[model samples]
Target: MEMVQMLRENATLLKLGYQFELPGPRMAATGILTRNQDQQRQKRMQERKAEEVVEQKSATSSNQEVPTRKIAEMVKHQEVCNKAQIRKPKTKKLKNGANEKESEDILKDLRNNLKPSVKSRHEASNLPPPQRSGRDDLMAAIRGSSIFSLKRVNLT
Candidate 1:
């Protein structure tokens, strides 16, 4: 009887060891699920904020009669803002070596000064393309980097 009991215990330990050696997803917990949900929530929030800015710009434009000169300025401002926002990440590679914080400040200022809009007839006639892909802007960033500058000297 004692021998049978010892064999049963050994079998149970071997089964547990084999199970532990099996490879599978280790994060079988609620933490990963909550983290993913949080990321999705933040993404939704950013999209909503961008939409709100567009709506506000449209509302203001419709309620007020902006002169052609002002409209032109707004369009120019919007274009500049769009460009800055697009190039924000690449600012670090600039010849002057602007830091991340400065680029972020510039972006904040641009966003504060101008908002994007939905094209009404007047805006449709005047407006340029709303946004371009990152690939389209990559060459521009590379050309503007210090690597392309013949006049730049490395102090190091």
Candidate 2:
């Protein structure tokens, strides 16, 4: 047929490094060319493996073992401590009227304890300011742009 001849011509052109545009739909009503039965068997085997993995996970979750060593260690530590002496020490109750006076005394002690450093403000400020150049600006611009953008493209 003419269609078959055209297909053969296209194949020859393609082999010779020439591009050819085929016209219309060239589909045939024939069955698939790849008739390998091994692929189906492999797919079924993979499904069975996945099912086994799921079964194993479910089995592990249902039959989880408690750590007996950790439980025993906790029990042993509890037995060593005396419950009566382990109770938290009671804080001395502060009288409502004396609380304000006590707080003022604490603040006074804190303010008296703080000592001013020997360094003068002018001495700290005497350090030179950092220098900026055009190179820094160029580097920042390069970092902001994508590396892929640096690639050269030919329009022709």
Q: In the order shown, what is each candidate's alpha-carbon RMSD? A: 31.7, 17.9
- Candidate 2: Cα lDDT at 121: 64
Poorest lDDT segment (10 consecutive residues) of candidate 2: 27-36
Across 57-122, the per-residue lDDT of candidate 2 in tens digits comes to 999987677588988999888876656456858766666756767988988988867755556667
lDDT of 1 by residue, 81-106 (tens): 99989987753374478877888898
Best by TM-score: 1
Taking the candidates one at a time, how many backbone clashes does each contain?
A: 0, 0
Report the error of model 2 at residue 87, Å: 41
